[model samples]
Target: MTTTPPPPQVVGPAGAGARTGSGDVAATLRATKKRLTSPWATFAAVVLAVLWTIPTFGLLVTSFRPAADINATGWWTVLTSPNFTLENYQTVMAVDSSQSLLPFIINSVVITIPSVVLPIFLATLAAYSFAWMQFRGRDALFVAVFALQVVPIQVTLIPLLSLYADIGVAGTFWAVWISHTMFGLPLAVFLLHNFMREIPGELIEAARVDGAGHVTVFFRLMLPLLKPALAAFGIYQFLWVWNDLLVALTFAGSSNQVAPMTVALFNLTGTRGSQWFLLSAGAFVSIIVPALVFLSLQRYFVRGLLAGSVKG
Candidate 1:
């Protein structure tokens, strides 16, 4: 009867292990919830998305309302106003030769498509040579090539315009295209060269051993693998050319039909202010093509276009 309550029933090893495991699981759950429910991260993301979308949302709402309503009231009053119409878009699209945004859009496409495709082609060739082929002063030349990106386009604009003037090509589509190509090349070469250099040398060696020429290897193997970077650069080039007013205005003639969307939209405004309603509608309209292009090609960026190009 002198036993102290069966020695207080000591915890067995299994029971101790179970209790420790439970404590660890509980701690992990708390840490997971703390991470997931972090207020700062969630708030920052929500705030950024909302801030980014506000202007787009405002323009969309404003575009549907009549000019009277837009000038009279804020876009917030949209729900209060019972009427919505496509008249703004209708009016924007119905411009005459002095202000036809659609033609300008086509012109932008002409400039942008060629600008993008040319650079990619040229860059790919240079990248392939730099990455795989051996030649004199290759590394030194690449460094000089990369050094070109540091120079601002503003610095070159006057010189290029002067050159174009001398060449009797100052105000033409060719001038704009060539200027875009030259401006875009250095970065293009740098990026594609980096991507191509990542390709394993063994594959190039094997392809060479199989009697495949450089052009054949490039088209068959490297071209397919470069899709992601090509898409990325293509989209970037298209956007730059589409949005560029300076080069288009400088190199492309006002008389020439190839004055791009930016120039067209710029002239849409009067000295006092734009036809705000028209400007908003035209602005959105101008963005539509680039948005579609970006969406179409964006998937290529995440895709591993280089998969299986080399052995592990």
Candidate 2:
């Protein structure tokens, strides 16, 4: 119209801002839901978890069932009969020399403790040197060490066994201990070095400014912050050493005195393999320690994983 029309009413800033905020919130919620429950992704995750858990669950069920029941039908059939017994575990824990797992359990403890401790302790020192100390060819040395991860354990086994034999340490706990230490060092140092680099340079500089030496800085400053990483790596090395068969077999052999639980468990399956109950119970018995270690350190492991995501 030719006549001046009323000026168009303006929307208030607050109203527009609120509307935008709501839209943003809705979009964020949608994205979160999409990530959490994409149809195919959800299905795949469920399927994978089920596939992984079924075997472990079956093993646990089989461990408690009577030998007759286990041989008569599959572990799944236990649901119908509801039979349970502790005799399998009793046999596994018996004091008899042939069937007793006590000595092997003790051996695993002995082997695993040193294997875990020595590597972590040595790795910490090496990692600190690499991450902080100035030296010629430090980077080259670190790269070379990291590259050692590519070497297969099998490839080194013959030479390592020979070397152990030459040193007269073969067929003893020392062989497994030192072998694990050497094999575990490179990866351990790499992981610890990377983690050490993630510490704030400012804090380190401040410590240096306050008259703290490298040793002081490492023990007083770095080690405290590295607890999560240490716990994570400890769990990893524990599981690896505990579950290891090839290394134990190669070094410790069938000698019940030095062989770990894994070797003992392997011995259970002889020519006939008739002792299904013993095998099941023995398997669960061997699993208990690692499971406990994981459960006890799970928090640290998760924290370590998240902290590792941060860049240096």
lDDT (CA) per prediction: 0.78, 0.84
Top-scoring candidate (lDDT): 2
Query: Can you write out model 2's per-residue Cα lDDT over 116-227, one digit (the tens) per residue?
Result: 9999999999999999889999999999988887776888888989999999999999999998888788778888898899998899999999999999999999999998
Candidate 2 minimal-lDDT segment of 10 residues: 303-312
Error of 1 at 214 (Å): 1.7
Q: Please provide, for model 1 over 29-124, each residue's C-alpha lDDT reduced to its tens digit, 9 standing for 90 to 100.
A: 676678888998899999999999999999888888898888888898767666688988887777564444667767887888888889889989
CA shift at 33, candidate 1, in angstroms? Answer: 2.4
TM-score of 2: 0.81
Quick one: RMSD of model 2?
8.4
Model 2 regions lying over 4 Å from their true place = 1-49, 299-312
Provide C-alpha RMSD values for all models, in order: 9.4, 8.4
